[model samples]
Target: MKARFTPALFAHAEAVLGQLLRFDHPADAVVSRYFREHRQLGHADRAFVAETVFAVLRRGRSIEARCAGQLSDRRRLLATLALVRGWSQRELAPVLKASEEEWLAAAKAMPEAELPPAVRCDLPEWLYARLEQQFGADETLALARAMNQSAPLDLRVNTLKADRETVLAKLAADDITAAPGALSPLAVRLRDKPALAKHPLFLDGAFEVQDEGSQLLGFLLEPKRGEMVVDFCAGAGGKTLLLGALMRNTGRLYAFDVSDKRLVNLKPRLARSGLSNVHPGRIEHERDQKIKRLAGKADRVLVDAPCSGLGTLRRNPDLKWRQNETSVTELTVKQASILEAAATLVRPGGRLVYATCSLLSAENDAIVGAFLDKHPEFTLLPASAVLARQGIACDGDVLRLLPHKHNTDGFFAAALERKA
Candidate 1:
């Protein structure tokens, strides 16, 4: 249910947006901090504040274009309500001053077509240019429109504990509306985004909050029972748990990352997962001695490389504002280095899947193409054939999922097989 708008709720949203506009910290972190400090705010009020602030973040450029004069957080929020949220002038009068009414009316009357293409799509010019070059003008606009909206809550049923049908039934029993995801068989897409932290299904690890696009990566890797698999750069072990369950918890699945804090965060999830074969380890880097010890021994290695995270804009609208060409350039270098190191762990005749939640070609195809040129032993496997073998339908040399096309986060993955 939508929170009933009040003057205090509007004040709270404006305050949060002020901090978020600074963009010093992650948007979620800043909102979380605010919530922690203000324990008095109820769930509905907190939801309203977060949704309002995020709406501004997702359409800040468009909101700015519609407004005249000095644009403060209050004006941005007002414009958002008027233009984006479809708040009628009658609806907004309760919150508006007489001086602001005419200005807001003007903003509401402004044609979005008058703005530049990037502004109309609410994308940074540099990023919009790159996407336009990659996907053309029309496609990029559609993609941007999808990314600017909120993402649906997708859950991956942990096969080790429960099947998709069982979990769906349980959710239905609890009055939560969900349906099987169109892409991943194990995925269940919730109609409404509900807090599931304390849900019985979540606590017992019957399902995990994961994107359907992310679940596809595990099928690409296709780990078998009793095999040795490596999840290189496994942050908080989301995919790692998926890999372990796919292996029936019989194989040794190593979840390696540079951050000890992220590995620590994985502990509770791992426990809830009921998987016995997952080994969480902290590596100094991709070339750590620990990684070198297992060189050429892994049956499968998945490199879910870190990128600019532009593809997750639906949930993390702040990333587009926070990331720039310079940061993305640096990420490409690290991604290349990590992919190279992870490739060494895949045994001859084994598989390696390089994947990312990035929409940029610089971080997706370009990196893989360059890597293939350097490593002759590794041959690119058709992503469609791999997914098809697992009963998932896809059609391409690589798995490229766009939110507009797939109803999932934008993802790119390429499977490679090492010659025996």
Candidate 2:
């Protein structure tokens, strides 16, 4: 049944939350499929379902703690709607019984400061400890608060097709309240989240739905026209298309990945992007002979390596429970291997950019540090200097964009050059 405003909506939210709680699949994917199967649900109803489910995810740990061990997917969902949504006793009277209402009152009345650190922060203890080792308690708490909220919708103007000023004026003319991004010249942050999938500008490929922080990584790579570049882990070619456009479609921009399925999705994006220089190719691994042919020849290489993805908690709150120290430890090893292989393709004096959406030191600095230790031929370049040269102002030898600090999804990027 389609989700309606009555008790069915509550039941529907619990059903979707049940699937997402298992952590078998991504929350967004499950939610998308649920809506697809029941297309009768309107836009407002969908938003209510999605927002409520995501709120439960964002505040799950604290809610569980508040429930005093009396919790189910349903109670957790209801309590989140009550405590976080500030639904009153009378407001919840429709769906909740008197006992449940009394329990909710107790949960809301509990003093949060008395709760354990993990519960108070709504983070796994292991994850909290890992972050606290670097960020300390106060800073980690601040970052957690920022990550717990919803992320802003940011769009990157495809400069090859549309300028920022023109896109901003057009959005204003359309009554979409938007302003230029603080960090990236190509960014336009929407004041409100509005669906643009069917908009004329989107149809014409005027912009790509990219995070403002993500747009900085392309600038860090800064591939020039006619230069050879590679997006080593080009999943769906998000950055690959941007790099091709940056080159003005003049260079051979190779998008390499192990999954042909993801590379296949790049086809439509490439067409919509109107770029002909990008080659979407699948390789067995970084050691594939096809990649060897470009060894020591490409002008720039980007290793947007996979990681624990904890930095994107605002978008994927389930990641906190899905990832652990063991998983992250294993990922660090894989990241090191990928970085080493990607580095081999950077010619003498060519640039190599190692980046991740992870904020962990083990995934970011440790991986880059190990690579620098093993490969003595590469020298670290000040990422800030590179951005400044391109007229993008950001400070840091290693670019660290944080949700609390930058209001952008957490991202880390390092620039290194092969010694001539």
Candidate 3:
């Protein structure tokens, strides 16, 4: 049967929304299952349905509040389409009942002042409070506004395979537009999202899709050509690949993570990038025997700790609603423990880089501050100096990139060097 605007899309959307709202499944999983069950929807139809449903989820609280507790799944979807998606009643008349016009008018007139801060900012109260604590009134508003926008696609040229200029030229030749990134020499901002999986350059291992902010983390580590380095939380080896490329595939780059699934995912990327130096290790925990064996031996280590993911709102807006105070508190403890354990892998005089895709200072600065207080031998090194030495000029002691300020995911990175 053909799926159309009359009933099919709405039906699938309602089912998808029910699954998303009722259960704790990740948004991607929910969407994937929906697509798998209804494989008849084409790419354009799928995109519309998925994007509309996501917009609703991102602003569910606000939309529900506008409906004044009279919310049904259909009404909520209609409200979301009108308000967030800017669809007029006439535009939706084909799908909505004739009786819904009055309700849509009232929803359209819903005052911003009447809404709670969380609804206004499309964030949870706990998340807003934490950001308020970290950034105060003005900056938090700015950050929230930035997070509401879509994220751009970025690519990191694999120097071991090809230089940035060569890759850029090849990409241009293929009619894929990209420009040099603001900070990292290896980073390039693509004009539009393109599927590069089967592209000649990508297949040849000329580049990898990585955010510029993430690429900066590699620069902060400043791994030497032949020194042993470890990406302590190298999920899917995003930073691990960058570090491996930086080391010119000469040094051993240990990619450690608790997830065997994530390590397994990195294997193909390793082959694509031609990184012969990477060692993907699945650790039982932060204190796994494999990790302990490398204690005080690494020349550089990166702790891209698991975080609230507040900084990645553009890519994963659902996180703002999913994360709560209790969850953040649990993560902070884990982050601190991971940093402590990862620091041990760095030899005296070696560097440990701490990074997270979190806008909250509690996860970034506070975690590092607490770690510094406990470990006397490690001293904070200005991230600017570290990047400058690597020919990447960025300001501030800690490298902070907000979506609004840098047009990248909100990220914080701090470099620490151990004393001899």
Separate clash counts for every candidate: 0, 0, 0
TM-score of each: 0.99, 0.97, 0.93
* Model 1 stretches with alpha carbons more than 4 Å out: none
Residue-wise C-alpha lDDT for candidate 2, range 104-147, written one tens digit per residue: 88899888788888788899999999899999999999999999
> Relative to the true structure, how large is the alpha-carbon lDDT of every model?
0.94, 0.90, 0.86
TM-score of 3: 0.93
RMSD, every candidate, angstroms: 0.9, 1.9, 2.6
Q: Highest TM-score among the candidates is held by which one? A: 1
Which ranges in model 3 have alpha carbons more than 4 Å from their true place? 1-6
Q: Which prediction has the highest lDDT against the true structure? A: 1
Candidate 1 residue lDDT tens string, 69-165: 5698888998888888889878877688889998888888889989889999999999999999999999999999999898999999999999999
lDDT by residue for model 3 (306-406), tens: 99998998877778878888888899999999999999899999999999999888899999999999999999999888888888878989999988889
lDDT of 1 at 230: 94
In Å, residue 102's CA in model 2 sits off its true spot by: 1.0
User: Candidate 1 — what's its lDDT?
Assistant: 0.94
RMSD of 2: 1.9
